[model samples]
Target chain A: MNEKKLKSILEKIHDKNYDCMILTQFNNIRYISNYAPTSFAICLLKDDPIILTSSMDKELAEKTSEIPVEEFKSFNELKKLFEKDNFKKIAIESSISISLFRKIEGNWDLNIEDFLEKERMIKSKDEITKLEKAAGISHKSFKELNPMKKREDGFTEWELAYELGYLLRKNGAEKESFETIIATGTNSSLPHARTQNKKLQTPILMDWGCKAEGYCSDTTRTFVYSEKQEEIFDIVFEAHNKAIKSVKAGIKSCEIDKIARSIISEYGYEKNFIHSTGHSLGLDIHEIPSISKKDETILEKNMVITIEPGIYLEGNFGVRIEDTIIVGKNKAEIIGNLPYSI
Target chain B: MNEKKLKSILEKIHDKNYDCMILTQFNNIRYISNYAPTSFAICLLKDDPIILTSSMDKELAEKTSEIPVEEFKSFNELKKLFEKDNFKKIAIESSISISLFRKIEGNWDLNIEDFLEKERMIKSKDEITKLEKAAGISHKSFKELNPMKKREDGFTEWELAYELGYLLRKNGAEKESFETIIATGTNSSLPHARTQNKKLQTPILMDWGCKAEGYCSDTTRTFVYSEKQEEIFDIVFEAHNKAIKSVKAGIKSCEIDKIARSIISEYGYEKNFIHSTGHSLGLDIHEIPSISKKDETILEKNMVITIEPGIYLEGNFGVRIEDTIIVGKNKAEIIGNLPYSI
Candidate 1:
């Protein structure tokens, strides 16, 4: 995978008219070189790739990375490796911070490139298989979770989130892809509400995911109670189901988003739908070519995405139904075999 | 707390000869304005300080923030707020990304300022109270965790970390301060080893923390067995104990690091002591005035920092001991009362 990714990156560098591409983002390095450093590590992709890792990370980097790893002495030593005038144009990741950019910008013609991101958008069969395995673990864990037992015991929101994390890991995940959201009652009204220290309320919304083999899986399930809660839940379920149903090769990502939004709009709760219907997921929990209102990326086979449409009524309650889907020729195949209804 | 912090910031800004300061880093905004945003948020420090949060964050911002919150429309709107002649030099956080810096560069003269970091290094009485609460929750949760039960039942390394997270929340923490590290046995050889989906091993190194009311707590404990493990453990414990003892108001941060390093060196394992002795923790997991070889900042009263020292032998095992401490007149007050021997 490292050699394949490196070859593609080298090809991209040549095609994009750059002498070298410098990767500072840890994940980018891990994606291309398989050495994810615990401390600072940089990968300079030239004719021959080299990973510059701190002395602390040298041993691990050398052990894991496909490329040769060297202990980084200083920036001056790194600068000297390249010719002062010949290696002028260098590509940098867009996420490089100002302080780092300031330090390295004095010599090179730095250009922010989305080369890695663009390449990462399309998943290989092996990558998709890892993602499916992650989704499988998350789904299986959710089934094993006795929410009713917690409901009877009156568990706090964070406790349930934490319990779910434990289950995911127990079911063969490295860790949660992102912070598990277990917002209950009115707290769920905030789209990204922090878990409160209170006991579980009438309705609970959980947005969670887990990491397996560096791949990610994301899912959201909202437990409802009252008639009003059930009413909102039904609308969200329709949007989620239809959005997934509409996903296929050649279909625009925004079109699927519109389908979900239009369903909620027809139910007279358009404004209540706060965020996008879905987003692509891979190494990162949230990745490029999201299923938002503006995204025009054409859905292709092996493109995994989520269809999570939520209805949030501030200071009251909210409901969201989400699922991961792998784009297919006719219709996207939902990764998990779990039932949507609780 | 927000008012007091803002007043100090206002005075600092004036003293630094700046009319307004641009706060881009999220934690800095939370420190001064009392709103830790879910998405993007910015603060423009002027006579009447205001926060510009994304539309998605407006509801939460309004509910949580002490300061006035407004919708962030565009960068052009920010340009309009600043009169080019009135504010010649605008101070920005050193941590702000180069991408954001480039976007706002055309608007004004930007100067990287450690304004917030310097002020945040010395914790207030109220801030220390929150840190103490966070530390208390973490220590209590660890004590309550039964690794034997988890391991006997075939729980993975990530499962143990997740269980601790749940317990922390149950004991009244907002969330885990950062990603919990639960590396077991051979995997623990890597200082920053991420949790894997494997069963328990001989020596386990768990570094975990929890956040309470925005303040963070950090702790690391290495469970060891074998003769080699016992030997490494002895060296790490001596370094950890001596480092904590050296933390006092009048001493330099580097002196504390040397205390830790010298002990490991005396045992002929200086090269294996990979990372820093410690780092200040509050709001952010790794904060300013780091206890490292290059840092010259003097330990000040009320400064809460961690004293973590470790020894790693590749493909063998690693041992690390960590604790949070508050600098006092002649000594340091350890936050959590958990016994080192478990």
Candidate 2:
């Protein structure tokens, strides 16, 4: 099923004078072989892909992978195999650890390549379906938890986070896409806040998602109480709305970020919006082509991304609104029906 | 204070003619500065250490980090700073990404160094106390879970895993050290099996842990139902007990592995044991000085590690027993008072 994707990557490697590509990221491997390793595994994408996985994972890999599976012995052994095969060039993912890079270094040329990233950027119909399903499950779970009512009840941030996770799984999600962020009151000022044991406070912020069939969904909402909190929330919500409206197939990812950032800046809260406006998400929550000032990747049809705009007053409180959307020919398609200011 | 730890690392770097070390691993940073990063951040160690964190993390980092904190702009700026400092040799952790390694490659001599790993190998009294508490909390939570009774009641692996996590938080734990593995019946054959929605079956193998005060505690226990399952369970328990008994200061780590492997081999189940005997744990669950045939590091006092011996029969069932222990001069002190079988 991934023949087209593997062929595309192989052609890129060949054009770059590389014999094969070494893929270690679980999502990258899964995209090719339909087997996401639970431990160390390498996918050698060449004329015919082969996966070398730990012995503990050998059985699962064999049962699920479209490619041939082998039990990994050592880097020394893999280096010898490459030498024996007389492979002239090897392309490795930029995410490879220096330790592994050093271990696999040989006489052959080895360099970082983004062939897999380029291949995985555009979502297929099957992948998009999974993404929508994951988003649906997340929305259903969030609604069931009812943050508006939960905010009044005294419950620690972690307790509510756990309840959301339980609800997500019950709604048919495989697992949480990432750690549920249940930052409350002043803690919400940190974009990536750790869930605490403190009871619920005003301006509750929760950024949570779930996985369905190896696809991820990301969403964030802030429940405001005070007049100031509501005012900040309105500004963030405006930015989030405008950014989503600006997404299209031909526009640059950074352009979308600029749209949201400019909206926040208009209200003198530009500096407070700390992180990127959004990021691409698929099997992994944080993918390439981030909606950031530094990124200039052109948005493509079927590309999934999140637009999260926030205003954080250091040591005071923060308000954020986020939603996942899909790039379209003319307009962006938001993933779920979750309210912006829930 | 981490003054002594910092001194040790600086002395090692000085011996290697390195001016400063760039560290990004959250645990290593936390060990030195008492501040664990929630997002992208870097700790530069020299005569004076400074942490360059994302703007979103600067407020928390400044409050928690013992060292100075600065907002990170870009790698180009960092490289310019390194050049201005006239650094002759710069040290980096082996775990650094090839992407980051390429970003800061400059006129200065850049090389992989293990100063942080070497410094973190030995635990302090406070770290050990935290580890003990984490282990105590994990044991208490597991006992309260009453897995034996849960086995009788019909509940999916994911459901029970969620409940265990809830109990872990209730008893006092920052979070799970790693993903809780709740494998049951045939799924137990895969050592690192994913927690599934399938109901609990015969021979439930759970490998779970929790974090307390940034320290980790790992343990595993298999509840067996059938005669063959009990037989395998007995052999694994014996190997686990013997391995724990063999742990002490001044012995090679491989020697302990040999002891465990020899027993499993005598029982004709050596091939069934796929992974290492155990691994060291501190802020991170898997640390260096692994109890494996290839690792020959000498055990030292104040080192915390786990002794887990498991046997997996593919397509059938698996059993494992694990415990965390502290290496003393002439003995090993097991972390908690959990029973081998329940």
Candidate 3:
């Protein structure tokens, strides 16, 4: 399984004329090696890749890493290990810190290239299975928590978020993909508002997710009680439904954004749609090929992404609907069976 | 207050002949502009500074920022704005991604510098107050949770972490400084162990903290059961105590590390003491001038840091003690009143 993930990256590195690729992003390293480093560990993707970790991480690394693990001593020693092999010109992740890049630079020519993100853009059957399973757990937990039914329970936003979190774990999620967002009332206008201690209000915007086997699931739903809130919610729901229907292999990511944006625009609320249509999610929540007006990557089969459309009316209220989907041979397969409206 | 924070960085930028400094790290930006970006945003520090944020964030930015806020467009447009000002060079954080650096490179000489970090190393009276408050709340919450007494209860590690999190929020914390680590028995051997769902064991290790107005406080306590665990705990406690007593404004960071490390070495378990002595913390959990053997930074007044010393017996169990402190004129001032031997 690890060999299959590494094959394409090796070919890419060879084409780019680099001897090896260095990966430091935790999720990227986890993609290549089963080990998700709890601390600093360097994954050098060579013909025979190795993970160099600190003494503190050695035991965990040796236990979990699919490849050979070595205890790191110093940069000088690390440089010597590579020099003995007469290596030159390395590809590094775009996320490498300048300090790390500098320490590893003097011995060889180093350039930042994201071979892993590109390779990860196309998901395998195993990866898709994890995403689907994560989505199922998240959806089931949402149903169990039933935010709409508990709307008037006098719970603070944080309390509701805690309840949902407990549900996610009890239903078999490893952890939440991100901190749960339980923005209510006027606070929902902020696209990425932090969960507050304020009481539940007329309109509540919940954006939450859970993880399964390192894969992530993201979802959002707004419970509306007033006529004005419902009117805005319907517009977002239409944009979301139409955008998912338009998704297919060969269509550019921006096309999906355009379809979603156009629906909101037709409703004369384009300016109120604060963020991108959505983004890709797998090991990490925000991955390559964001579904935004500026992103142009073509959709491909088995690439899982989300379609979240929101309309925020600043101090009044906001409404958003989100769902994860799998890019299919011809159409998008929405991941869960949650009701659109309550 | 923000002006006081920006003065040093502006001088450093001018000394290096750079037109301005570009900051993207959320805390660094917040340190200067008082607006922490939820999504992507750029802060330009100059004679007259401004924060360039997404339209989605413009509302919040305008509300919170001490400096002027503007809508960010493409990098191409940003280049034109700087070109109009006759800017020739700029300083950036080491954290700037290779992709972002390349996008902003065509017109200006971009270099990674740590002026903000060097400046943030010393906390202000206001920052110290927040840190102290954060530590107070965290300590009070731990007392309320009382892991020692809860050891016999049928609670999972995750459950303890959740209960502690609830207590932190209820006791006036904005949120946890980081995810609470609740490692029980053998799991505690991993320095950075994740909280598990397994039932609580005899010896419980919890490293936790909470945020007070964006400043962070970190503390760790290991609840030991058997005499073997208690014996290891005393060694760690002695190391933690002596290393902290050695903290003064004039000494080097490495000296403090050496003091703790030497005591652990004397106990014939130097190899068991796995990570660093400690690290500085403020807006971010880990900051500049780490209390490690390699760090030669001279301790300075008002520098807030942690002194956490531990000994792990690989597959058996682990014992650790940590405390946040303020480097004083001639001694160290531990932030919280939490009992050491509890």
Query: What is the per-residue lDDT of model 3 for residues B125-179, given as tens digits with 9 covering 90 to 100?
Result: 9999999999999999999997866666788888888889889989989888988
Tell me the docking grade of candidate 1: medium
Whose lDDT is higher: candidate 1's or candidate 3's? Answer: 3
Predicted candidate 2 versus true structure: per-residue lDDT over A1-342, tens digit per residue:
556777777889889988889999999999888998999999888887789999889988998999999999999899888988899899999999998899999898889998878878899898999999999999999999987677668788999999999999999998899999999989999888999999988789999999999999999999898999988999998999999999999999889999999999999998899999989999999998899998999999999999998999999999989999989999999987887665
Give each model's whole-structure lDDT. Answer: 0.86, 0.90, 0.90
Candidate with better DockQ, 2 vs 3: 2
For model 2, residues B142-224, the per-residue Cα lDDT tens digits are: 99998878877888899899999999999999889999999998999988889998889878899999999988999998889
Q: Write the per-residue lDDT of candidate 1 for residues B198-308, one digit (tens) a residue.
A: 898878788999999999999988878788888889999999888888788999999999999999999999988888899999999999889999899988999999999
Q: Considering only chain B, report the TM-score of model 1.
A: 0.97
Clashing pairs in 3: none
Highest lDDT model number: 2
- Mark the regions of model 1 whose C-alpha exceeds 4 Å error after superposition: A83-86, A146-149, B83-87, B146-156, B196-199, B223-228
lDDT score, candidate 3: 0.90
TM-score of each: 0.93, 0.99, 0.98
The runs of at least 3 residues in candidate 3 whose Cα sits more than 4 Å from the true structure, single-residue gaps closed, are none
True contacts kept of each: 0.59, 0.91, 0.57
Deviation of model 3 at A165, angstroms: 1.4
Q: Which is the leading candidate under TM-score?
A: 2
Which digits, one per residue and each the tens of the lDDT, describe model 3 over residues A1-342?
457778889999999889888888999888998888988888889889999898888888888888899998898987887798777888888887766777887668888887899989889999999998899999899888877767767888888888888888888888899989998989989888888888888688989999999999999999898988889998999999999999999999999999999999999999999899999999999998899998999999988899999999987788999999999989999997888766
